[model samples]
Target: MSARPRPLLLGAGTAIAVAVTLSGCTQKASSEDGAVSVTASDSVCEVSKTELPAGHVSLALENKGSKITEVYVLFPDGRIAAERENIGPGTKATLVTELKAGDYEIACKPGMKGDGIRQKIALTGKDTAAERSPESDAAVAAYRSYVLAQAEQTLPRAQAFADAVKAGDIEKAKGLYASSRIGWERTEPVAESFGDIDPKVDVREDGLEDGQDPTTDWTGWHRLEKALWQDKKIGDRERELADQLMTDLNAWVKKVGTAEITPTSMANGAKSLLDEVARNKVTGEEERYSHTDLIDFKANLEGARRSYDLLKPIAQKNDPALAKELGQRFASLTGQLDAYRTDDGADEDSYTYTSYDMVSEAERKELSDGVNALAEPLSKLAAAVAK
Candidate 1:
């Protein structure tokens, strides 16, 4: 998986109304217009309001913290409704997401670690169901189905990989590793929304929480990757971690049906996928052990394409120029990625690419530039769909 506290960008648009107060974490209620003004410092997370009409909400986030911060809108059950990660110190960004009428919390994690400082909030008015058009509703339903299917397919592949690891079949485990991650790389936003699963299933070594002992604390695909590739052998501990990964993935598969899915979220998630490509895949930071980053890159692009294609009807109607540009950009980036393919005849799931370690720095730069070009136009997708 891509690194945690991943950088995110929301496209420019007319700001929606939601408010956050900057005082101490005292629970207060107010409904106000304009963007939710969120100020994150080293120890404080202040929102301008604790109450708002439920629908589309935008937070104008400014990070005052000395360390990078992450902000989340979370359901009471601990499921993340939406999140903006890697908000660097002294920088500002906007997070746009849809929320149904419910009680929730807005949490700010300074340094992008641990349970964060939180403020309780409530959304008044009816659920967003009546507010959304039938077309939007259909898009959400289709996306939910897609997400569930990916989760279902992932479980069996992950089981095979885990089984190989336990059997001490090093080469078998290595072969299964990249394939097992395909469904996950394709649908990470939904998986990450669960809050607890990503850390256990996908976290990289540098992404570990504070005070976590890498030996005992880290338990995920990347951990096993390190053991198989870097350490050059699987030990008893790797076997146990492999089993634990299966348990975590089972939980993710079971929970996929219940995840909050909305048109705006699907659009935003597509942009998030591109961001994943830029931050980790382009940098060659992801899949560093196996050098299978290209596989992940392709998966992320396909996932983003899936979301955009679903919402294309609405986007084309609302903003035809943007829709056209997006299509072209997606094509351009896809062409760039296709250049690295080692097996042209292979199916999407089984296509092989040049090992990332062998990718020249100049080639990496071209890929990065292509991703950035697509990402800029892709960022506008959420607002276009919402329109």
Candidate 2:
């Protein structure tokens, strides 16, 4: 609802998506190292925008810093073609550059900062086939790791922010949430180098954050936080909804340490939570946009459940506590999600100016039972096997 591009929430998510799409296949094949060598200042890459031809090339970057340095081809379209790492100050490191026919940039990161230092590399003709080459297997693996670390760091921080929200420290919660999001972003370019890693199935690989898409949809976990937690224009309408959302989220988090599991039990329970998230998807903005984007978020969460289910036997055999923890976390998140789908979510009080209505005792008990049932196999699995 703010004036900016929802930058705090979704910028990181959109960037990560492109990284996965482009991973591995971003560079051109290289047999030898030969590129137009340009000497850059400590600040800039010393190349104009239209300098490098749109084809295979390489850079032997010389870091003029006091410590380790890196130089990257920061493409205009968010494509990271090539980079050289650990280039010692005054020593040269070779980086192969494979560019397509478009405008591109080059920048040396942090230690050697001037301006973000821009360059425009233009391809005279089509180089899509040459440029979209498959990445080496190792490259893909490294990138996948980069993404997972990003997520692991982000999830906990977001939870902390949510906790602050639950405690009524709105300002503190907002600040923490912002800081947490910063962790998710900033390192995105690092993950961009990976080729061949698809996040949906690769738990090891970092999945793109959904909150950052330009189009109107809740992509990231905290994408709507800004809207819901703002000081201005947050009348009963916003505050009421915020409370509804958080109440569900809190209950979900509480369940994390206590959920029960087995494939059948987990599936039935998880599916219920999944339906809650799906049916309650926030119709925050009514703008017509890519339906696939909506479908993707829904599918990604669903896939996450499948992934958990596939690994259930392992949990059943070993690591039941993790299973309970994971199950509770998933359930909590889905329940919180249920609070957002204003139009279709069962919690109508958020969307309408209704009084405090509670879920039916029968329904509540069923959900509780479904979530906690997984503990049987999970506890056994943890006691008997390796996590």
Candidate 3:
């Protein structure tokens, strides 16, 4: 909504090792080894200690700014090592990560906009094999397999949707739209690593590069969604967009194959999926043209739940009660979502969802409450796994 690429509102495999930093509310200025305290104010980010021992490190971040902010640990290669979002004014959150000895940057984004103010930090220590946990490794492997499987499935679905659009088959394209987006929504974080392709393929209408010049600038699934659901036809322009989408999706399939996955990221990805549901899906802001936001919400919830499931064993090993609560919360949220199912199919995946417009205000509130309930405990999962 602000500018290009839209506003900032927004490895692998081996059972990669991870460690969780146990954190709690603390007003102390001093930090313990393997832990740092971060404070975000008007324009700058302050760290209690910039140098950390390589292994597991926890950042206890407190937002002192009036607006919501986010923090990120940028790896040397520019990949994000860890990040925590939506730390509102006066709120605190913890980020835990396992790092090999390397140079990295700490980024604090105030007001959740722009490239965040950056600060360099160093991890100085010897590589310790003892830091790697078997539980963490297995969790990472399960999540990587989940993500790779989702990406593999996305290709054929995207191709089918694109083919339908290119052929000017309105009804077929409309039906395939939501289903096609499921894979992308589930593995969105990985898809986003492809740079501009993510936006070109998935950016919503509100996120169009230049909303003023809709004819030339508007594109992606929402663009084609509008053409199929509203215009009811795909002409040269829509066809061209469809072709480009197929090209980008093909590229995404290739990219996803090599996308990195780790335990910390798996936990963060789960939280992010819920954030997507809360930020846009429940508000009816995502599916303006198709009224299909619930479809995306369901997909996102599935992604979040899948991530949690992969981390559950480790989370349970560390904190059994917390893991049990998380499972119950997910089930509760799923039950809430289940109410929206139409009788169009008997299978869970084949069931159709009611349009958001048809949902009453009370129902929406219930949905929001359900998400909040789930998020409260879901938020603790990453730390639980790490510990």
The 10-residue segment with the lowest total lDDT in model 3:
13-22
Q: What's each prediction's TM-score? A: 0.90, 0.32, 0.85
lDDT of 3 at 11: 23
What Cα-based lDDT does every candidate model obtain?
A: 0.84, 0.37, 0.74
Q: RMSD in angstroms, candidate 1? A: 5.4
**Candidates ranked by lDDT, best first?**
1, 3, 2
Q: Please count the clashing residue pairs in each candidate, in the order shown.
A: 7, 28, 4
Candidate 3 lDDT over residue span 182-235, tens digit each: 878887766664445666777765555433477886678888988877777779
Q: By lDDT, is 1 or 2 better?
A: 1
Q: Model 2 over residues 1-387: C-alpha lDDT tens digits?
A: 111110111122232222121211222322234444534444445432234455545454555556544555644434345544335667764444345565444555434222234444445666543332132223223334433554455456556655665556656754554444332232222222321111211111012333533333323333334443433223433344444444433433332332222222222223332322222222212101211112222332443454354545555445566676667765764463344233554532112211112334464344344434432233232122211
Q: Model 2 lDDT vs. the true structure?
A: 0.37
Q: Compute the lDDT for candidate 3.
A: 0.74
